[model samples]
Target: MPYVNIKITNENVTNEQKKALIKGTTQLLVDVLDKNPATTFVVIDEVNTDNWGIGYQTVTEIRQDQ
Candidate 1:
């Protein structure tokens, strides 16, 4: 079984978009690694912008600056 974890900022991601992400990730693994979709696992984590940081600043701060 192959396990994949994906993390993204907690923005207003719709359910349809999340479903597409999960399906696409699984398909990629299937195509590249010959992994079975039935056995592949994909988990999406939505972190608060304040909790997700980059370059010594949180995503919230980065977006604010933008």
Candidate 2:
């Protein structure tokens, strides 16, 4: 079994976008690794900009500073 996890900030990505990411990545893993699509799993997490960090600052802070 192969596990894949991806994280992205909550922005323009919609619910459908998240579903597509999971489906596409799973298909790729199945085709290239010869694994069952059912056995592959993907997790998408939507985080607030204030909760996510970059360097020593939160994403919200960085965006404001820029």
Candidate 3:
């Protein structure tokens, strides 16, 4: 089994986009690793802006500065 974890900010992401991510991730494992789609797992973690940070600044703060 192959596990893939994808993390994104808690921005407004559509369901269709999420589905595409899952499908694409699965396909990538199938094509590169020869993993079975049935046994592959793809998880998306949507983190709150306050909980995610970059360059020592929270995403919320970065966006606010922008």
> Which scores better on TM-score, 1 or 3?
3
Off by over 4 Å in 1: none
Cα TM-score of candidate 2: 0.82
lDDT of 2 by residue, 1-66 (tens): 889888899888988899899999999998898989878889888889999988899999988888
Model 1 superposed RMSD (Cα):
0.8
| Candidate 3 residue lDDT tens string, 1-66 | 999999999899999999999999999999998999999999999999999989999999999999
lDDT of 1: 0.96
Order of models, best TM-score first: 3, 1, 2
Q: After superposition, how far is residue 34 of candidate 2 from its true place, in Å?
A: 0.8
Give the least accurate 10-residue stretch of model 2, judged by summed lDDT: 37-46
lDDT of 3 at 8: 99
RMSD of each: 0.8, 1.4, 0.6
**Superior by TM-score: candidate 1 or candidate 2:** 1
Using TM-score, give the best candidate's number. 3
Model 2 whole-model lDDT (C-alpha atoms): 0.89
Of candidate 3, the 10-residue stretch with the lowest lDDT total is: 1-10
Pick out the ten consecutive residues of candidate 1 with the lowest summed lDDT.
2-11
